[model samples]
Target: MLVPLTRQKFEQLIPRIATGDQYRYVWGKFSDFLRRLLASVVAVVVVLLLRWLLGEGFGGLLLPFGVVGGFYWLWGPVLWASLRNAQYRKYKYSGFFRGRILDVYISEELIGREETVNNKGELVYVDNLERRLNVEVGDETGFSIQVQVPLRRSHKGIARRQVAEMIVLSNRADLSNITKVTDIYIPSRDIWVSDYPFLQRDVFVEVSNRIRRDRLESEEESPRTPRRPPQRKEPPQLPRQDREW
Candidate 1:
């Protein structure tokens, strides 16, 4: 069964996450790619117009300026639109609670034994490996689940770490982080937590439970259920009829 990760477990797994400027670099590249593609299309259009109207010489010089200005002019709106769209998508299809699962991946099982020291200088139990689960939620603004199992205990520190990393990355880099994701696949029960992360506990629980129930009911109503065949009585006079014939 899947189990949810605790906050403490999440913090322990923080070592694996990439932070600081690394996230910025990755997001920047993505943004730049989109901007460049849009700009290129605009530039091509401008050049085609310039060549047809002004022809050679000064047109070539003016073409560059036209393209450059067009580039800047288009940037703000495009950027706004991109961000807005990203935000919209994040929310529109948010897989919060019982929403759609964008993707799922299974990682290697963690096993073994280890010991660690906490702030109290006391020995803490640690495991070598546990099960890892990744679940993504939300539309444009989305959240994700990452849980790790300890070789010793079922502590899902790795999973929590992944979730926390996603949260931080989204907030820092202005990714679509519309909501907090808590109720995810719990390694403990191998089922989803009956709550959404960001919402009120009661509300999240209610919503999640309702969604789960509805899905179950729908499945029960599916036409794939086998129908019982009609029963037939045995033919009692077969032997006598055969003798008469």
Candidate 2:
């Protein structure tokens, strides 16, 4: 029973997606390398078996090459999807933290170039855009943390200096692990406000108040003007004495 993935399913799955840092860890890198190596080995073995069975015929010579090429082309995306599904299952049982975003910026990186068949049945190269939302968020105790959320190039409405109530999840076994932002609430954005009606007005009020207090404290801590030294008074000169000498 195969169910078609719809937009609703994709939206539900977004929160469960793992952070990029998770994929960059040593073990993560090793796992990725292992997957590629295994895929390549399997592809080669399958191609050899086809050649042996078909014995150098037109199908054996041509089909084996096609099979190997297709396997290599689809391996990356298939591997990523498997990793994401595993991560989502783990995140479903994790605890969530509440925090407010203090700042945000977009970080762009080139993952790789992709090839797709055009309408004319010719392959074309396209750049794969990987944009991440690097956010600095603070908890109630003023302890701040940075987290990166993967974003599509077409995603809009997120800007620097926007405040967001973030719901973050972490790996319990590894407390120092990178946190995943499961959900976010931006009071300043009308679209978000309308989308999340359950968010109370007091939540926005509290966040706004905290932001103002932090700004005022930062301004007060700025360097102040130094006071000028008092001037010394000179003794009055003796009355001009006529040259009595």
Best by lDDT: 2
TM-score of each: 0.23, 0.35
What is the Cα-based TM-score of model 1?
0.23
Supply every candidate's count of residue pairs whose N, Cα or C atoms clash at under 3 angstroms: 27, 0
Model 1 over residues 144-205: C-alpha lDDT tens digits? 34333212232233242222112222231222343333334332233433211222334334
Total backbone clashes of model 1?
A: 27
Q: What is the lDDT of residue 169 in candidate 2?
A: 38
lDDT of each: 0.40, 0.49
Cα lDDT tens digits for candidate 2, 61-166: 6675756654663345444544654554454223223345677777886779999999999999998878776767665444566756566443367665565554
Off by over 4 Å in 2: 1-50, 53-76, 95-98, 105-133, 148-161, 165-167, 171-245
Q: After TM-score superposition, what is the CA distance of residue 180 in candidate 2 from its true location, in Å?
A: 4.1
Regions more than 4 Å wrong, model 1: 1-93, 97-197, 225-245
